[model samples]
Target chain A: MARLKIESLRKSFAATTAVDDFSLDVGDGELVCLLGPSGSGKSTILRMIGGFEQPTSGMIRIDGQDVTRLSPERRPTGMVFQSHALWSHMNVFNNIAFGLKLRSLSRGEIQRKVDQALELVGLAGYGHRQTFQLSGGQQQRVALARSLVLEPKILLLDEPFASLDQHLRERLREEVRDIQQRLGITTLFVTHGQDEALAMADRIVVLRNGQCEQVDAPDVLYRNPQTEFVAGFIGQMNFLSANVEGGRFRHPDFTLDVEVQDGPAVLALRPEALRLEPSDSPDAAGVTRATDFGSHIMVDVELRDGARLKVMTAPDARWQKGQTVRLAASAFALYRQNRLLARGGLPVETVEGRSRHALA
Target chain B: MIRSYSSTSGRFDWMGLAFAILLVIVIAVPLLVVFTWAFTEVWRYPSVIPQKFGLRFWDQTLSRADVWEALFISLRLSATVTALSALICLPAAYAFARMKFPGRDLFFLSFLASHAFPKFGLLVAIAAIFLQLNLIATFWGVVLIQLVGTLMLMIWIPVAAFQAVDRRMEEAARDVGAGPLRVFWSITLPQAGPTIFAAVLLTFVSTFYETEGAWLIGAPQIRTMPVLMINFINNQVVVQYGAVLSVILWVPSFIALIFARRVIGTGSFAKGFGA
Candidate 1:
């Protein structure tokens, strides 16, 4: 295992900047995920780290040794491409043994190492099968085995599960995490899927438009996003435009006490943070729709001002169209002009499971 | 019940059957004529079949020293040209498929332009150059001329073939610690093997039947089968000998066609094209 340090890396192509002033330090034996949507420079960063693409500026050091100018073959990194990229011309054994042969290892040694790698990926005795003959999931395992057989200092995965079906992707997600932890390899996984990043990484680095937005533990990033983009991107959030006046947040439909300066702001509330209580007050919201998914129900409410909000509640909470409901947020993050201002739990006043708000 | 089912499904369409028979006759008649001429001792006008049939012409043609020498020259020249064309085109094709250097499109378009030019006209100009260099009537001269005519096929097909291979496959090879040369040998070349084989076969057959280039450059001294066949046909007295030689020339092409069919049937060729 090795610690990878990237300092102020940037890549530009002609007129477009793909990755700009990006930097991160991945600890030894830690799997850090670079998470972003398409065109967000996550793949470019991964490619730079793998030595497949040269950075326009900055340095990449592994274990304190500069490897920025090294070619991919010389870099101590192994990458599993999004397509798996198994050699169609070679059978599974030869595909995994290619790197070992490049090192000029003996026949016996290559065979043993390949067998061990195959067993690690749970594909023992599949060595003789042709790569094209394998199923999509099995082809993915062969790709992983091919990279793992090299025993590089770091393993890079570039959206490896993007091509698989949802069911197989979920299963492979757990398998990949298990193998990474068991081997304790320092890994950098690039993916656009939030769930994959959250479930797989020790820490997630969220990127936007070639810049780092936030980097933190998955749960920490989800609960305490540092920017408006992160707050909205990490989960389902209902954004409400409000203003701070007299130490309280004043929205068109409701007003609540907050510790902030008097200025324009936006409040981001997660669906689980909001509670919906049936009420008959004139300020109450109307339930437009509700969907139950066994464990919880997602309720959509439209206030008197015609602004819609999503709230998650217990599955037993029955709601119907045209029903009047009062909205209460347990926690929220307030931002001013895309910068975080304040975030915490709200002290809501309630009476018999209903929010106590005066009707307008 | 089985008879009733056959009667419904196997109802014959007379028009389709007649078209199939006509197509077979159109293809087979010329082949039958060639075979007959190879064995005929006497064939005159308005005779559907030869009055007398024998292998005298075939035996005589096979026994002649000039015939065998011309056959050897044709095979040797074609093999050399195919090898040289492949050597020149493989790397060019790879660069066209993978890299984005300036003037790449212009350079590829030039190759297509050369391919589109009339071969006989180009050969006349090339023959002039060969004469000044004293390359006329030499074996290497014929091979060089054939390479110029056939280079486009060798390059164009393989460019499509190489482009069809996913770039990720090569990247994965590099990621596993294979260098550029190793990656090519283990990954790129093998994936393009079938297409490259087809190209080689195509160049070989075209060079083998190349009458114009060989006639223009190596006719009097370095005699290929096509040149000798042309000479025999120009003289009506030895037309039967030309027929025998033509049958012999068709053998290798027939075998190559069969081999190409098997290679194409393997379905490895054209794996990536238009995918």
Candidate 2:
């Protein structure tokens, strides 16, 4: 295992930049996921780290050794592509043994290593089978084995589970994580999947438009997103436009006294943070719709200003169309110019004061 | 959509059966007549079949020194043309398929220019040049002219085959510690081998039957079988000599077709054309 340091990595095509000044330091044996939507340069960064693509500028070091200009064969890195990329001309044994044979290993040792790799992938007896004869999941296992058999210091996975069905993707990801932990291989996974990143990565790097948005643990990213984009991208968030005037954030349906410069702002509220209660006042928000999702009910509420928002609450038969209700956010983030200004609604005084101010 | 008539319930497919019969008769009848003519000592128009069938012309045609020389020349010219064209075109095809260089597409399209015009006119122009260089009636002169015809098949089919190879597989090989050359030999070439072999077989067969270039460039001094067969057909009073030569010319093509059947059965031959 080895630590990977990417410093100021930049890559550009002829006209546009793919990755812009991207930098990250992955600890030894840590699986850091580069998470983003399409065209966010996640794959470009992974390719640079794997030596598939050269960076337009910057340095990549493995274990403090500069390897930015090394070829893929010379680097201590192995990659698993999304297509499984198995050599169709070779059988499973030969595919896994290809790199070993290239290293001029003895025939008996190559055979032993290949057998051991197949067993590790739970396909102990499939050495002689052609890659085309295997199922999609089995083929992916063979791909994983082919990379892992090389015993590289760094493993690069470029959305290896993207093509798999949901059930199989979950199972294979778990298996891969288990193997990675057992071997303690430093892995950098690139994906457009949020749940996969959240479930598999020790630290997830959320990217947007070829720049780093936020890099943190999954729970921290969910609970304390530092930007409006991160708040919206990571989980379900209800963005309510408000005005921050004289240190008091003002919305049509609510207001909160916050420590911030007065300007236009947004109240980014998580669905679970919002609660609803039946109210007799006609000016209170009206429920437009409610969906029963087995464990919780999602109530769509329209405030007095006709802005709609979703509130997640315990299953309640009373949350139906045209039901008047008062809304309350247990915790919410206040943003100004797309940047987080304050996270309020924590203390009892603040939560109660916001409601009192709204009612006034 | 119009549904085709189904033949699944043991019903007779008369249209299909008629088409099959017509295809066989159209293709096989001339071959049968040629074979008959090759063995016939005498045959008159009034007789439905030959009055007597024997190998008289086969022995006669096989006995001539010129005929043996023509046969040997034909084989040598075809082998040389096919090998030389393969050496020149395969790498060009690979570069056209994989690289991103200036004028790559234009250069690739120019290979078609050889076959785009009337072939005889092009051969005449080349033969004029060959005469000035004292290359006329030389074996290499004939090989050069025949090489023109091979450019299309040798480059086009193999380009499609090489383009069909998955780049990700090569990248995966590189990731697994193989260098660029090793990846190409182990991953790229093997995947594209069958279709390339099919292209070679087609090139060989076409070169073997190439007549116009051989007749135009290698007249008088170097005579291929087709050139000799054309001579016999025009001058010889005995019909069997030409017929026997026709059957002899068909031999290599028939063997090539058998190999082509297997190659095409694997589906790579047609796949080389984006099938």
Candidate 3:
């Protein structure tokens, strides 16, 4: 397995940059997902890596060698497309053995490898069936087997489970992750599906408008997003405008203390992070519980300046929507995640190159 | 929803039915007469049906050296012509149908525009060129002329057919690691099956019955079915209405048309071909 490094990779169409000047390293045997919404440059970056599209400007390195101009056949990377793309004319056995045959492997060896790949994908007995005769999931397995048979240094998947239903998607995702981990193959999975990325990636690179907004483990990304974009994108986030006053911040109806000064100039909290309590309780503290939204309770209360605010609460707790309550995120944590997740919003820490600590 | 009639149209007339039936009889009368005359026996002036049914004419044509030679030449010529023309047309038709070259629409329109004129109109000019090239009276010469006149017809019909196929097939093929030629071979050519088949059949029929090109550039010894049929009518004193020439010339084509018909009716032939 090989590590992949991209430096200032950029791809642009006529009036838009599908991928901005972005860079990230995928270590050996590490699975990194380029996760974003549609048009966020996730697939474009994947295509650039797979040699389908030429990057406008960038250096792509595999292990340590630059592969900016190598053809897909010459590349040591295997890619699986969202459409499955199994050859309809070939039978199950031939489809898996295609790459090995191309490399002029001996017939017996090719057959062995094909059979092994098929068995790995759990389609061992479908050797003679035509690709078109297989079901959607079966065809997907065939494609996976085909790529896996090559045993490249790295594997790239572009929304591999998008076409499947929810149940099938879940199963296939687990299968792909399991196969990838078992082989210890470095993989780059591109998808607009955040759930897919978060569920499987060793580190999730959440992209926005062609630039990387944040990259970290799933829990870190969800608990503390780096940028305002990441904060809004990862999951449900409720943003409230507030003005900082020395060590404290004042909202319309709530006054909270910030340990630091100005950053993104906006305060944001996830629905699940904010706890709720009864507004009229004599000992009301932290966020008060409010509206019952079935899955989770939504709390409505007043800010310091009397403006209304809503936060999420646990589903088991009883809450009402219009009641007033206090809100505190001390337990929610400020910089518990990466520095990007911190409110100071400065370059508090850098993962690549040398670390530059903020002199708070 | 407005008030619309379910059982009846706004205007329905018994007179329309009578008129339509009358139209069918009028149109079918001439074809029925040709069939009647084709089956009839020898007659002094006129005869509605054959005096007696016999295989004399059939045997006569079957034994004739010239008729057999014509049959051999026609079958060989048509087979080669259809195959060669399809090879040239299929790729061009596919390109026209699926891609956007600089002058694609213009070139396709020009090819279709040639269909407006009868094949005979270009005979004089083509003959002059053929004579200058000293190609007249050669089998290859006649075939070449037929290829030119029928190429556009072969290409256009199939181009339209390819255009009607699902556009995703090509994109999918390419994404699956197939290059341009591979995609065409596996996905494109097969998916355009029905239209291509119809084109091949139409091209074969047209070239088989071709008189102008074969007559202009072909040798007397290399006459095709229609060319020989014309010669018989023009040169012979006693009109040869025997079944010999007719049965020998038309039967083979009839059999061929049946094979072509299967391809035209349904596109099941495309199954193994498309990846």
- Highest lDDT against the true fold, candidate: 2
What is the Cα-based lDDT of residue B106 in candidate 1? 90
- Name the weakest run of 10 consecutive residues (lDDT summed) in model 3 chain A: A347-356
Each candidate's lDDT (Cα)? 0.88, 0.89, 0.72
- What's model 3's lDDT at B270? 39
Candidate 1 docking quality: incorrect, acceptable, medium or high: medium
Writing each residue's lDDT as its tens digit, candidate 1 over A194-285 gives 99999999999999999999999999999999999999889889888978998877776656667889999988889898888788776677
Candidate 2 per-residue C-alpha lDDT over B1-275 given as tens digits, one digit per residue, 9 for 90 to 100: 22235558666667777777787789889999998999899999999899999998999999999999998998898889989999999999989999999998799889989988999999999999999999899999998999999999999999998998998998888888889989889999898888888999999888888889989999989999989999999999999999999999999999998977876556787777772
Better of 2 and 3 by TM-score: 2
Per-residue CA lDDT of model 1 for B177-213, tens digit only, reads: 8888888888999888888788789889999998988
* DockQ by candidate, in order: 0.78, 0.79, 0.16
What is the DockQ of the complex in model 1? 0.78
The residue pairs in collision within model 1 are none
Off by over 4 Å in 3: A241-265, A277-312, A317-360, B1-51, B86-113, B116-138, B153-202, B215-222, B229-275
Q: Tell me the number of clashing residue pairs for each predicted model.
A: 0, 0, 22
> By descending lDDT, how would the candidates be arranged?
2, 1, 3
TM-score of each: 0.91, 0.91, 0.75
